[model samples]
Target: MSDPAGRLNIQLRRTPHGFACDIGSTRPVAASGLFCGRSPAETASLLPLLYSICAKAQASACVGALERACGMDSDPEARRLRQVQVAAETVREHLWRILLDWPVLSGEEPDRQAMIGAQSLVKRIFGAADPNGVLLSPGCEKPTSFRSVLEEAASTLADLMAERVLGLAPDAWMERVETIDAFDDWCRSVETPAARLLVGLRDSGDGRLGHTEASPLPDLDDGTLAAELRGTDAATFVARPCWGGAPRETTPLTRHADSALVSALVADQGRGILARLGAQILETVSLLRAIRTGELDGDSTAPSDAVLPAGVGLGRAEAARGLLVHLAEVDRGRVVEYRILAPTEWNFHPDGVLASALATLPDAEETILRRRVQLLVMAIDPCVAFDLVIP
Candidate 1:
């Protein structure tokens, strides 16, 4: 209705110290009005249509919350299926940024053809994992023989990443290219635009720009999140979420913070643009490996839904950008309350990671400043279109 996902507005002002940032969003915390009266089944069916980006993740969270609220016991395979779908979606999102946006940032043309192929491959992967398209529905039967589908999809995704983003196989990159020295060599040697962007930032002395001391969001249990969602101040908290009285980041950099590649990058550059870029690449590789191995042990710091009082449930899905949360209240077999806490709210909070990082930027020419801001914003990867104003 309002704009599937609303727009983000970022304004920056040059300061004697560095820069000041103001992040604003038109996204609503309570998207409940649209599905307040729908049945759990109807709500699940409609959520994907309402969310164009990360539709699978949205639907998965919606269904999980609704099922718990409705007192439905889901098939265990259902969770696995959801994981595969979300994992494929994550890979697709990362590839979209690397294959398309990274090139433009590096002063090269977008790899449209590679992106097209990547999209097609992702659809095949999603299709194989969800042949009936009912994976999000409560009590839906898991498709049989989807293992082969995933197997093929895994190989295809790895191959695509190799040619388009990594310029080497994922295993090789992780084993031989993730070290501090080796990573720099890869950036210098790889011909892909992803590598070019990282190298450009390092060579231009902008690699350490946007460094922040913001901590990654800790794993929040469902009960804790559910209590907050049901609290009297739920609306305010959801709009500008903070845990332990401080805003924490939930992005690729946080999700894969433990990876050797990401760790090495962060050690070298702190949690800056270069580290963020490396994290994205690392996550893409890791998810592809998970798909190949048929073991998506889930990477979300937020656990799945847990039912609280009768008819109240909280669901979480680790989306491409970060964690997505949904709170649902069902009464008499119909939806009564629905609220969403999206990752954008946390990462782009007025005092959150992006804001802190922006404050660390070095003063520069207007064009260069804009470029730096763009890199930081892209690293956060907000779902909504962002209008950047620097004055």
Candidate 2:
């Protein structure tokens, strides 16, 4: 059982190859066990309370799983609104890192005022798009026409990102930064916190730090995922998931691996710190555009739900961090078994992507090693705090 409020403990001991990293999590991996014995509806209501970090994604997965288990038909409008909320939340999460965290990496103060404005805009626009709060209710729909509100907010957000973060319009930035050399030029020329952080890493010769060979997780049908969750060692599987006996990554880099900018960076940098950071920036641009147009690029699949058998189902949502999944087994309208396989389990597993990158760090001064590890960790963006131990 992982601790619900627990953090990751990363212990790096010197090894002949450089370092041997052991990652341990106290996060409550079994928190879904709380859903057992509750009615499906009750479980849906309880999800938001239990998981507060990505509340919308958590609730979306729970509602979809319960709806599928009950054999309910999909609600298109509900799905659209949920996507909008998720998209806005994604932009917010990425901007938080850009506006607040990136500056600290460059020895600058975080722009608190900008973050406050960003959050306010998010609440106004996405909140207007889904005023009924129906995300938690299965098969429920109360549509409100807020197109103008959404479009205006999207435009404002785009402008804000251009002014405060990108140092250029999102479209212009994407168009210009297609090659590795172009990326370097932009980092050196742009006068923004995000750009400065990248330039700092490059100037310090740490741009390719933490390069790893972990492949991005591939798409799996709901049936295959349900079977894996239904296995005898489901608990172990959720805590430290592996596909075909190997750990895979499910972060922004994985989600945007095929995008022009990200692909070019990864091709040259080998999925290192710079490539990972590039993916997040690229995704934010895509998400902001989606908010305006009501369409996410390459996000064709709606929240997926598959009824494995009578009263058993699996649900999936493409969350900000990665994929969020929930499985439910109900009998007589009450939950018999419930499981959640969060992206955290995949990206932060003991031998997962973070571990692979940490293992590659060459022995150096304690401060240098610690900073490199922190950058890699931040690039991946774990849901929990990490405690680093270098001994």
Candidate 3:
């Protein structure tokens, strides 16, 4: 697999009252321009390779955009298959974070075996759904036993979530959301490795760490997004995505802003480390339920027809992190322009969510502050590698 394109460099300076952070990303910006001039099919085929972190989501968005550009209706079976793949990927990604990164915050060795199991589960789903591994090709025939494969995959994932992450059955854990104190108590007292990490965060004062104002939920419509892509300089829009002249957040919390559990957490704790973590866990459980019940289905903004407008075609999908938007302009069946707005660009904007959180870090020894900052960044979960610089 190709190494990720770029890295996040965070610099911290001690201020009188607290600390100030200057975050910079060397992550390759606007790399989607490479897709220009390719056929929509070709673009969809290559997108997964280029963005392997969220390959399924990228492929979904690419296919959605190209379909819109060509004005073709999505094949229902294909759409359902894609949703299953996306859900599997999302569950796997969240498990990786919980099994691997969460341990780091708690000073525990990562459960490498469990991480490997999670990886294998995702592979099993993909292997069964798209045996040829053509992630973007629509209407590919599935084996007659494909539904059984999905059921097994979902069952395995549910077991992992219950045993490692939640310390309760998925349904039981979800019910605890109605009582935050009971849930918090479980997080602090449960014997599971994941709960141990949460306990560590609480003991280390992360419950209040990285507190800041939550950005308004993203509400950009297709017309607004297309106008911005076509009107603003392409380089500017890709490098710095802003809504109404200000950086906005599009995390799972923002994407599910009205979710009962998410709303309750935000109302109780604001948007701190705890709230962000809660949103992720809640989303994971919800996705698991949807996957098992075959309720994973949704429509995109991509137009459906062969006769599409010559202007930009916009497609958006909620990735494991947040909203991922893709824009393409096709002329005579060839891509003339392409751009992507990833969730990282929104949350890690210089004056954006991550920055706001960093600015709120309380003054402390450099080492302690750096550790706390790292945990906060992990909560945001950028797709690229990052380093923390204290000077």
Task: Note the Cα lDDT for every prediction shown.
Answer: 0.84, 0.83, 0.77
- Show pairs that collide, candidate 2: 2-27, 2-28, 3-26, 3-27, 3-28, 4-28
Off by over 4 Å in 1: 1-4, 297-307
**Model 1: per-residue lDDT, tens digit, 1-391?**
5565788889998877768999898976566569989888888888888787898888888887887788777566777778888888998998888988888887899999988998888888888888777787866764453778778877987988898788899988888976889998988888888888898898887888888885878887788888998899988988999999999889988888887788888888888999988888888898898888877743342235543788987778889889898989999989988988889889999999999999988888888889989998988788888899987
Consecutive 10-residue window with the lowest summed lDDT within model 3: 136-145
Model 2, position 160, has a per-residue lDDT of 92
The best candidate by lDDT is 1
Model 3 CA deviation exceeding 4 Å by range: 1-4, 132-135, 138-145, 300-308
State the TM-score for model 2: 0.95
Candidate 1 colliding pairs, count: 0
Instruction: Provide the clash count, candidate 2.
Output: 6
lDDT per residue, candidate 2, 1-391, as tens digits? 6556678898988976678889988888898999999988789888888888778778777887888888777577676777777788889988998899889877899998889989988887767777766656876655664888988988898999998988889878888988889898988887988999988877776878889985778889888898989899899989999998888889999998878888898787778898899999999998888788867432333544443778877777778789989999989879999999989889988888888898887778988888888899899888888899987
How do the residues 77-104 of candidate 3 rate in per-residue lDDT, one tens digit apiece? 6666677788788888888888888887
Candidate 3, number of clashes: 3
TM-score of each: 0.95, 0.95, 0.92
